[model samples]
Target: MAGGRAPRVLILLCILHLHCLQGAKILTISFVGGSHYLLMDDISQILQDNGHDVRMFYQGYQNMQGYEKTSVPYAVSTYNMEEKYLKAYDELFHEYQREIFISRDRPQSLFPLMTLYAKHCRLYMNQTDILDFLKQENYDIAIVDPFNPCHFLIVEKLGIPYIAFFAGPFSYSLGNGLPSPPSYVPMYLSGFTDRMNFLERVINTFMYLGSYMVEIRNEEIFSGVIEEHFPPDSRPTLSDLYNKAELWIYNMDFSIEFPRPLLPHIQCISGLRAKPPKSLSQDLEDFIAESGDSGFILVTLGPIISAVYRMDFIKEMNSAFASVPQKIIWQFKVSQWPKDLKPAPNLRLLDWVNQNDLLGHPKIRLLVAHGGLNGLTEAVYHGVPVLGIPLFADQPDNIVRIKAKHMGEYIPFYEIKSDKFANMIQKLIKDKSYKMAAMKQSVIMRSRPFPPDQQLLGWVEHIIRSGGGGHLRPYSYQQPWYQQLLLDVILFIFSCVALLIYIIVKVIRFLIHLLYSRKKQKQN
Candidate 1:
């Protein structure tokens, strides 16, 4: 009877543990871009596969028809504000392109562009219908891309813990209260590596501070919007709310990124978008096979900037491609080819191509890209050298890192003469060192103990099981900025040093006076 009872007790405990691991209601939010949406979709699918109920709220101009194919349900809200933002983005892209190529000094201030994005996010959240839907969901957790603080407000209103899903390298703002000394870690968008000279450090520090200032300004703007939507008592500052995230999953790998200290709550989830190379269409396969000894080059500017380049620039690129001996596969935006410009028989232009699939091909020699993170990761994964033509955002930084690693070179768009472009392409193709370095980095990137997707799923499930994983958050999160920076300690030390100096000076003066008095008395 006793043995039977023990077995029953064990079985009952097992049942309880299974029940505890049941599905959770997850809410995901992100701004609408192909790369952003794809990342969020991957996250949602992973959670849903594990028996979690996942829903998404996205804002942007891109069509959401792609979501229909996914099992996870999502809602997209686009207002007239998207058109305004798109127009602004187009103008900014052109301006940035010109600044990168034509001007000696590129504009340092990204505050205005960041502010515009913040306003667009606010507009999306302020919609009554969107807010109502979010409220109705009764979500258990909110996973948000912290590009803007507006999602923090949404999660606060929903009354649930949220996670920060960084789509790029770990952001400095996300490391608030944590020990990320700028002495080593490069500031986002600074394009400097960890190794820096005195001047570079000064510039890096200024850029770091500037980014924080921008964040603070946006926070104030967002705070007013949050206050308007919620009761005064319930209104939470964006800074306070942002730090409340239970976990931070940054799309960074230490192998690729500079070494930096991270709190326990932060996890690196880089290369989640990477997957096994898929089969290319028969035509593409045949094209690569026909490339013969001199392999092909793949060129793409990613999805957003496909239409941003001017025709004259496109013509110049075409001319450069004509000069190169290697076969070229260029992903251009327009279907109609330019009538006047003639390309070499080896050049092929297409509207779209399976980028990863092409990179993984043995006949492919190099990649010419805009340095988007996804494209960079693919090139690195396949061990292909790159010639980056960076435009804006993280592109410049990404290219700088690639060059630092000796994996590629970049050509400024304004300097895109046919001879120079052809020579650069030829150099990358002929140089075995670039290919070797890329292959070495590829080993490091792929050496993780587990697959990236599995690692992500495991951490996410851990968070869900532990109910927001609050214990993982560091004590630093609650500390004041001065405390976090040890500024108070520095001030105390400075005061002590000043007091010691004063006492030493006073004693010296008294001794001098005593000696002078003695000397005068003797003389009398």
Candidate 2:
């Protein structure tokens, strides 16, 4: 009877332990498409795996964004945004790309697209039903994509504590009292790495200051939405909302990115997506095997680029691929390929390839890419070297880091000559050091004390269980800009030193005059 009682007591204790750790309700928001949705979806999936109820809300202009998530474990709410503004923005971008490649002009700051962004925000707030569902649900915490200022507004309206999942560089966190020294930390769109000379540093500093101007413009973009939807008395600036985020998990890993200063609340989750790849499809296997010992290059210019970019770019790429001895697996649209041009003999054009799987294949020589963070992270994980033909966005600087690390090289979009492109590919294939460097980075990425998935899961749960990450936040956010920078303290010290020097000069002058006067009187 005593033994039976002991077993029952153990069962009760186990039940009690399970009851103590209840799963927290999490709401994730993703309004932007592509990588933004991918990151947020992954976050929601992970939370659900841990027995939490996760609801992901997606609103965007792009229709084709979320279809890739075929096995989502979380509940999702989606809203299709009006595309009137996006159509106009696309026209401007199309023209902008034309100007850069056709005119042989130097690259400049991209179009602001403020109107397009603002319109999306307005449309998103107009979703009364979705907003009502979110409000009724009463989520414990919200994980938002700060890419669209609209998601921030939604979270603010709901009055829930939030975290950020960002794909941009560290410079974006500058406004939130995060340390972003311009000397090393490059501007988000500057396309520069940490290592810069005197002139580059000057440019980087100016670009850093220019980011504030861009933020001011971003505020202007969202001002109308706030005025139209929210109460007049409590207008929340997008910049202010960005500052209040309890934690930020970037879609970046140190394996590819340069090291920079990050706070306790700020962390990177790049290594989480790096998985041991599965086998490719049978057709893909046959294509990869055709290269034999020579190997094949994997080219994916991202989904958007393949569809929008002109045929001249394709022609140049094709000409280059034709020159190389190795086979090429290029991710491009079959429908977009012009019938007038002859396809490269060694090239296989696929609408989609298991990019991660291809990168993991032993025969993958080097990745011919646009230098997006996702593919770069995968390449580093699999120890595959990259050679990027950077088109736009952060691709230039992303490639800059790859070149700096000596694991890869980058060619400007305007400079894709057949001979030069082919030569670069040959160099990468022949060079053993690039492969070694990539492998070293892979080892570093996987060899962390705690793997990236554990870090991501632990920190998020830590925040959820504690109600918020208020304890991890530094008191610096509450301080004024001058105080945060220690500008006032600097001025005080400078003023005291100046006063002391002034007094010393005055005393010395007076003493000198008195001595001279006495000496002159004696002489007289």
Candidate 3:
């Protein structure tokens, strides 16, 4: 070959290589309140790091707002968290475990409550705005957490591949019969923990059905607006939305989360756990170095729950730590220490410190947390056992999983007196079992084929490279559950048997009528 031809051939190969490595520029749209964004942001960064473009469209409220004005490529949608919503959420979260919908107790009760709560923060929020943003950007695929089932319809309109990101302990696959997480600790049983019994399952079923209604409503609202505003060839249903999606990136590991049958499209990528920030400030470093190996306890109630209960928990924890020989590092996120409550020699409080770093530090032994999944992941990541004080939603479920794994112990939030808190702390630290369990999980969690961040990128690349294969679509509710169980055939047989019985009865009546007419003639 000529020299010029060689260069041309090389150029062709390079282009082929680039095309082979081609990944879709993923556009992630997440709701405000849920912790979905935390996982999505990590996925987004991984995509970006691998030379794939990412654009985030989030309602600038709550934690999502923290990324605002940062160098990340993102756009803020019209949803903003109002003061009233925050106040109302605070009130609800205080008793969240009592009120969370495990099943359909009411129509549009659980989801609408959450959406309405979110809407109270931002009024003019519509599904169209999100669609319009998607249409303009022309994203290759849309990654959404299933909680925002409303947004799934956006993918149907644009004919794009979408994957619902499940970012918690639970799993929801199409073919999985119904949406049931491994186990949920009953709200009524505060002390004794067990799986949802028959009644709870019935209620949970109702709640799931109610969520379906909300999904339909959301689809109608979105499709109706699409029909009004833009030209549409065909309107899409909720089923259509599921069909168009390519995959479900379940944010859980099989090792940590129990094995459940999942759809072909669903893949477990649970390793993408996170802590606030790993790097500590100079003051934190100095504090850790000067602690003289007393082994501090890192206390945090999580972000939302922290706002309400932090001060009280801090005071009680302080009281408990007074007798213990260990130091205390409280993650308060504010410098407003009570003037009267002077800092003890062993106690240091900061508004915010790198949570993972604190856990990984040699000086830190135990974590006092509200049992959020992220905190649990970090605790497990560093092999530090927890004294879980769960607040709401999946916190109780998470704590149950933690304790079941033998990695941690849980104390009910209502039972968080100083003495009890101190006893639990002492039990976790002094006992070798908790750390051993955590270390076992850590070893298994680390032994995975790839880091969660890289695994996430691979899935996205697969979508782009395969041009969004239909094979990756989740089989959720696709097969009539009746068909799967051979119930349809059973019903057909029952109907046929009934028809045969009816025919026999009709023939018998006809014969009797004829016999009666003959007898009347003879009498005449």
The whole-model lDDT of each prediction reads: 0.75, 0.79, 0.64
TM-score result, candidate 2: 0.90
Ranking by lDDT: 2, 1, 3
RMSD of 1: 4.1
Which structure is stronger by TM-score: 1 or 3? Answer: 1
Highest TM-score against the true fold, candidate:
2
| Candidate 3 lDDT over residue span 1-524, tens digit each | 59889999999997996775654567776664435776666677777777766777665554421223345644344455567766665566444433432331232334545555334323323455655666787777878776555456445555556777777654234322333442442221122234567777666555544554655665554454445433566655555555556776666765456545555666788757643346677877787677576678888775544444445655776788776777788765454556567666777766555577788777778988877677778887778888887765557667777887888888765556778878888888889999899889878877788887878877877777677746654353477757867898999999999999999999999999999999999999
Model 3 TM-score, 2 decimals: 0.75
Flag regions of model 1 displaced more than 4 Å.
1-22, 63-112, 173-175, 336-339, 491-524
TM-score of each: 0.85, 0.90, 0.75
lDDT of 2 by residue, 313-368 (tens): 77888999998878999887777778898889999988767688889888889999
Q: Is candidate 1 or candidate 2 better by lDDT?
A: 2
Model 1, 1-524: lDDT tens per residue?
Answer: 99999999999987886575555778888664557777887787777776777777775454322123434444343344556667886677556545554444332445555566656656776687867876787777889887656677777877878888878765644434445567776777777888988888998888777767766776766766776777977777777876788888887776567777878888888787676788888988788778788889999876434444456777778888887778899876544556666766788877777788889888889999988787888888888999998877677878888898898999877778878888999899888999999998888889889878888778877887777767988777777879978999999999999999999999999999999999999999
Per-residue lDDT of 226 in model 2: 90
Query: Where does candidate 1 clash, by residue pair?
Result: none
- Cα-based lDDT at residue 53, candidate 2: 86
Model 2 ranges with Cα > 4 A deviation: 1-22, 60-69, 82-111, 505-524
